[model samples]
Target: MNNIVPIPLSIGNTPIRKCDFLSEYFKTNIFVKDEFHNPGMSSKDRPAYFMIQDAIQRNRIQAGGTFVEASSGNTGLGIALIARQLGYKVKIFVSKSCSQEKIDKLEEAGASIELCDNSNGLQDFQSTQFRAQSFAAKEQNAYFTNQYYNTQNIRAHYRTTGPEIWEQTDGQITHFLCGIGTGGTISGVGRFLKEQAKAIRIWGVEPRGSILQHYLKHRTAPNAVRPFDAIEGIGRNFVPGSFDPQPIDQIFQVEKDVSIDMAQWYYQHTDIRCGFSSAAVLASLKCYSAAMRFHSDDNVLLFFPDHGSRYLSKLYAENSKVSTSNAHSLNG
Candidate 1:
């Protein structure tokens, strides 16, 4: 009798596949974890599901209550879907930077929408987060799913995603890479991998304009941090409470243009359309290649945050006009 564990095809159990195309091109064992398999089609589904459950377990909310949150897109949509399914009303505050597709989906999931100017480079991104808090304060039975500050954000990944990767990879993962946002995913997963093997390298990828790298160096966010550069969920002008930089081995920043090109290249070669931030992780690996520390046999996994459907209006709108040939070459 076989003792093999059947792979789960459900939320929080997305598949991790070794990419032969990427491994061949990069001359290393490159694996891509497809978070799009989640019901919300993104890694945000994990936290959204976990946080809401946390609220219920702790009596932070009850049936027919209201859920409140601020999101660039994925988190809000995830909450909206969960809240709707569990008989709760929801309100989502979004930065102008959020794509129309995400907003439409949030509405379809029965979320009352509010707009914040922070995402449009008008002010600090925290404005949206604070706005949601204030709104939740004045509303009846409104439980704020403060993803940015809530420790539950990290707990979600630590409890579920971290163990999933360890078990799925058979405890052989050598490196864990992903884009940093609220800092929950990397912090939770990175910390977990570190505990399993202190030798595991945790590399973080950041958008060029993101202040996370700046915060890591200066221990403070800049007063005039650059706004989201056409990519959502990865770049942050303010350091979120969920962000924990302790487990990160290195942080790589990539330009938006190059990240966009690589995302398309990945799709053309693999038929897997990933979100822009996830593409940034791919570009980060290219930058890491120059260091030449990674061996061909090392198992390196890149965590893709979400799917491309949420970014269709922006990142994938004119995909054909861009070519990856000039994007980033091993020689260059």
Candidate 2:
């Protein structure tokens, strides 16, 4: 792998594995997309690679100019990885709540980091986004690549992610499940899959407190509001501009412990180790497959969003209360 030059800038050819544990318990076939193999250790690498490529092609990024954006973790890592190889200066604004390990990785990738709202304790996603915007506004050469509003993020999924899944599954994919963050993964992939086969079921996984599930169930709500949850990388105070709510068949809200347990169990049982979002997705998949009892031959696909390595100190460390308690509860 070291001999390969420039790494070819491609997303992983992730495999679909039938979950033996889940199949026995639920009496149905269950499959997962192992996104941890992607370059940046998460599915976000797909969009990050393409987003930078598109920016270069369109001349949105001047030669040797600095790139700037804000992200929770994976997106920043994605941008920083590409910028380092391409010889561009990069700075990423991250929320104060983001893991220190992620910040260290970003800095290691040659990115300057700005901590957003560190003093005031702005833990909310919307507040952090607002702070990122405020910082972006003052930078002279900074390009605020809004992942939430950017069509490129969706286009990345539409052109690359969706095609890869469709081809990999050999058109046998009957249901799609993903952790919804920016809605790019769901919107783009869902659109393409629907266009290819209208029978496909697209479900978005949200944190327990997220409004997306509620919004999908009841479109008549007067206004959207933000709620706090332990889950990361999915759900926002408001719907992203890139989010297309119509194509979503269902939105499943998962508990924090459920996600933590699922991720830990996967790492323990399988070779794949992914972030909490992946666990939420697996939990959702279990629930969905159990209720629907998918046909014996039918294929059900779940997207494992990001790797859990970045969450080591918090999710993997012995001193980390969340993982310890979650493990205890699961044992109980």
Question: Which candidate comes out best when scored by TM-score?
Answer: 1
Off by over 4 Å in 1: 1-9, 119-126, 222-228, 324-332
Among all windows of 10 consecutive residues in model 2, the one with the lowest summed lDDT is 117-126
Cα lDDT of model 2 by residue, 206-227, tens digit? 8877777776777643274545
Listed in order, each prediction's TM-score against the native is: 0.90, 0.86
Off by over 4 Å in 2: 1-8, 118-126, 219-226, 286-290, 319-332
- As a TM-score, model 2 comes out at 0.86
Model 1 TM-score, all chains together: 0.90
Q: Ten-residue segment with the worst summed lDDT in candidate 1?
A: 1-10
Q: Tell me which residue pairs clash in candidate 2.
A: none
Angstrom error at residue 37, model 2: 1.4
